[model samples]
Target chain A: MRRLKALIKKEFHQIVRDPSSVMIAFILPLILLFLFGYGVSLDANRIDIGIVMQDNSPQVQSLIRAFENTSFLNAQVERDRREIEKQLVAGKLRGMVVIPTDFTRRLINPDDTAKLQVIADGSEPNTANFVQNYIRQTWVNWLLQSGLSEAMLTVDERVSIQPRFWFNPELESSHFLLSGSIAIIMTLIGTLLTSLVISREWERGTMEAMMATPVNIIEIILGKLIPYFVLGMSSMVICTIISIVVFGVPFRGSFITLAAVSAIFLITALQQGLLISTVAKNQFLASQMAFISGFLPAFILSGFVFEIKSMPAFVQAITYIVPAKYFVSCLQTLFLAGDIYSVIIPNVIGIMILGSVLFIVITRKTRKRLI
Target chain B: MLNRIKNLVIKEFLAIWRDKKSRVILIVPPMLQLFIFSFAATLEVKNVPIAVFNRDTGRESWELVQRFEGSPYFTDIHYIYSDKAVKEYINSQKALMVIQINDDFSSRINSGQQAEIQLILDGRKTNVSQILAGYVNGIIDRYNRDIKPEAQVRRSSQNAIRKGKLTASPFLSPASRSEIVPRNWFNENLDYIWFTVPGIVGILTMLISLIITSLSVAREREFGTFDQLLVSPLESTEILIGKTVPAFIIGMLEGTFFIIAGIVFFNLPHEGSFLHLYFGMSVFLLAIIGIGLLISSVSKTQQQAILGAFAFMTPTIILSGYATPIENMPLWLQEFTVINPLKHFLIIIKGVLLKNVPFDVVLEHTIPIAVFAVISLSVSTRMFKQRLE
Candidate 1:
């Protein structure tokens, strides 16, 4: 017990003495929070759309008014058609809504149908799709309300669908993205600190002296882990506070549940780092391994940025091994849905299983003897 | 003097080339990550799981179900037997949305009344929900148009109602039916791989330069060989060359290999001038090597340098417009990205590859990158000199 305590104190002293750990622990979270919160956004709002209305009809003007009212679109009037296409290629205009010259003439005559042309810059399909849908919806609503068609025989009542969203009614992406950021941040801190710890000992020639001591491998591993585990936890706390307070992402789940799940995930992340450090005693290899094993998987495979189900089947199968996948699932559900047992329980179990497997592997990889 | 610098560069190259692990580290990981991340890192949403709860037994409802099943966008659709199944599927996250057809769907449509369909989406994945709703709406809109034909329109209201039992809407006149013609320009199919593969070239080049150059001096310092190099008869300029040249060459080679792979294997379009492409890459490598040298000089350990590189990476990627569009970012953030060399390189490469832009267009983006390269080179050489002293 005393040896473990002495080793842990030594680890703490090392961490406090190293400015890099301190910088990574505190400063990195702030940078990431600011970046994820303000810098990154998936919301396709305020898209620039050009309107070419060759007709001067009141109905056409009303249709244009519908496009202007929505917060998603910024409707601009361009007199020339050639200029609009140039602007689209230049990435200035996302879409163009052209109201034809014969629009009012067709509306007056029962047999003649009018055509509205919507040309979207398909270079960016996402924005193009959004522009098409919003314009189509607006036009359909206008058609429904125009009351230009005479009523036919039979009942007028029809079936209508009422859509009710369960959680996150406004569908704000920031709320979920901030939650997933916590997983990425923890993965970064956990792998970075632990990999540095073991490899720094090797680089500075302190491992020979440390191994000469009476302490066992488990004592050393535990000592190395406790400080970084605390560091990782503190980093998590900092990120969580920033997410809730600074980003205004509601913390719907209990703090205890959040801490518990984070602890399991941090264990897996730390063990993964320790395994890299043990396998590659040099700091360069260790850090590179940490990045390849830790940051990439956590960021890409964890479903933080990309949806797992949307990926190809082979890629989806691979995401099963990524520990951050479980943590992100738990964190997002916790933040948005407030501790639904079904999600939290299964995700926690998955993380616990990964952590245990990683722990066994780290123990097998760690050794006291110096070559 | 030239021979001395050449020997120093050879020594640096041998240090990486002689070690099998270093060779693998230098070459393999970038290629592997490129292949993996290019396939993985995508914002394009496809194969979203949805559940269908059809209470109607009509032909129209069955055809609607068939239409949804046929779409490549929607996949793994579960047909729920009861309301309990709907709640369970959503709660367990098996379904992103549920398309519920009411019992009177067929009756209403058959009797010339509009039938309503309910789309209940699990809003937790908000981005997916929004896009899924758009996809569903698109399917329904197309279906709505198919029921009404342009060729069979008549002026007599009775004959129109009789002929178009389900098609004729009280509010929608046959003549005034407007067709919205949507044309997607450069990327007609909107394949995301074509977009991201070119971006991988910019990212992988930055990674190689940043990691190699940052590690060069830091590795020497960690092994206590930095002082040996300093005490040698080699000039400071030669020392800088020894550190920057090999890594710069490797970075450029890797970048060129990636571009070729993208064009040949991935079918990525290369519309811009090859001369401009190489020019942009050289300037980009210069800036990255400068940043790497600065990091190596400042960091006392290999660990610190790697961490510092990571610190630069997060912001560079976020600001680079690689994953997300720069225009979507706030005005202040967009302004901040002006200093990010990765952002400039991304614009240059992506514009060249995808946009088929001319030299003037390419030069506009490359100029800023060249400025960054100049600043980084001068500052990093100054820092390298300081470190040696």
Candidate 2:
């Protein structure tokens, strides 16, 4: 027990002395959180669209005014279709709404069907979908407010859709993204910090010296695991505070629950790192392996940004093994939906199972002798 | 001087290649990531499971349920009898959304009265929820129009006549509806793979170049071989060039492999000029190598190098308009992305591949990357020289 304490103390001193580990724990998370919160947004707002007014009619002017009124669209009015099409192809415009010359004539003459030509840059389907939806919505509003649709039927006759966005009513992407980024940050700190631990000792010829000491292999693993586990947990706490206090993302779950789940996840992450370091035995190889296996999968397959359900079946099946997936699920629930044990319990179990498997692998991989 | 630099470059290559593990790491993980991420990194929502609560038991409500079932977007539809079940499914995340048809829904629709339906979405998945709402709105609108075709026609004519924008004619017909004719120009199908595969090319190239160059100097420094390299006959410029050449070659090879894979495996359309693509890729590589070397020159240890590379990499990928659009970002960030080489490269690759962009436009994007390359390379070279001295 005394030897374990000494070993843990030594690991703590090493972390404190190394500024890079400190930076990875604190500074990198700050930058990543700030970027995810401020810079990266899935919400499509202020989309640049061209309004090509091929018709100079007063009726068409009101419709153009309607397009300009919305906060969603940044409308640029032009006289020529070919000019705007050039901008669309150049990728300057998300889409172009061409008000054909026959627009006013068809509106006036009920015998003709009027068409508003909307050409979208299909390179980005999300933006294109937004363009189509927003333009259609703008047209519908114009028809209603202009009293054009008033003569046909009463408002009561139309079907009304009341969309209730539960949990995050404002639909702020930052709310979910910031919460999800915690899982990513934890994954990095857990794996990257410990991945180099065993490998650095081996590469610098310190592992042999350590093995010659009175401490056993289990003591070595525990010592390595405990300090970094505390470091990762503290980082997770800092991230959660920033997510709640700074970003104003509501944390509805109890702190005890958060800590418990994070501890389990950190153990899983640290063990995975330990396994890699033991196997690779080189810092360079270990860090690369940690990044490829730990960080990228956490970012992509964990459903932090992209929906895992939307992925192909094979890829979705691959997500079952990604520990971050369970953690992200737990995080989204804890931060947004509160402490629903049905969601949290299963994911916690998954993390526990994975962590136990990793622990077993690490023990089997570690030996007292040099290869 | 040329011969000295060539030997150093070959030595760098040999150092990397001689390690069977490093060689495998370089080639295999990237291909694996390319396949996995290209499939995994999709914003296109499909196969959403939803719950439906039908209180009306009417034909119209059943028809609406059928509409949701028919959509490719939604795969699993759970029918619930009680309101508690709706909350249960959503809270448990078994259902992304819940469609609730009120008791008066069918009766009201049959009586020509406005009926209300509630779409309860799991707001935790913000973007997906919004998109799902849009899909639901589309289905409801189509159902509304299909059920009330004459009402839609009457509404259009009445709207025009009431506005007094048109002269009232006795021969008024029901053909006055204004429809939005939308055409997706470059990628008609808007296959998510096309968007993702091209973006992956830039991402993988950045990853390979950054890891190789950033680790090169730091590894030497960590192993105490920097003093030996400093005492060698080769100049600092030759040393830097030696380092740059290998990473650049590997990055280009990876980029080329992915570009071909994107076209052949994914069946992505190659609409633009290969000359323009290669031109943009070369400049992009130089810019990345410069930044990687900058990180390498500054970092004292391999761990610091890895972390430093990561610090640069995460923000670059996020802000590059790779997964999300840059235009959606705040104004300052959008301007800041101007210096990100990945941002410019994605535009070039996507443009060349999908839009068949003109050479002038390709050059337009390449100019920024060239400027970035020049600045970062000179700064890193200065730093490298200072460190050696």
Best by DockQ: 2
Best by TM-score: 2
Candidate 1 clashes: the total is 4
**Pairs with steric clashes in candidate 1:** A112-B175, A113-B175, A122-B185, A159-B116
Candidates' RMSD to native = 4.1, 2.1
Off by over 4 Å in 2: A151-157, A368-371, B149-176
Q: Compared with the true structure, what per-residue lDDT tens digits does model 2 show for residues A1-371?
A: 99999999999899889899899889999998999998879988788999999898888999999999998898999998888888887898999999999998987665667888888888998888888888878887787676544433443246889999999999999999999999999999888889887789989989889989988888988999998988888888899989999999999888899999999999899888988888788888998899999999999999989999899999999999999999999999999999999999999999999998887766666753433
Per-candidate TM-scores read 0.90, 0.96
Error of 2 at A203 (Å): 0.9
Candidate 2 chain B weakest ten by summed lDDT: B166-175
Give a tens-digit lDDT track for model 1, residues A195-225: 8779888878898788889987878889989
Model 2 DockQ class: medium
The lDDT of model 2 is 0.88
Model 2 residue B37 CA deviation in Å: 0.6
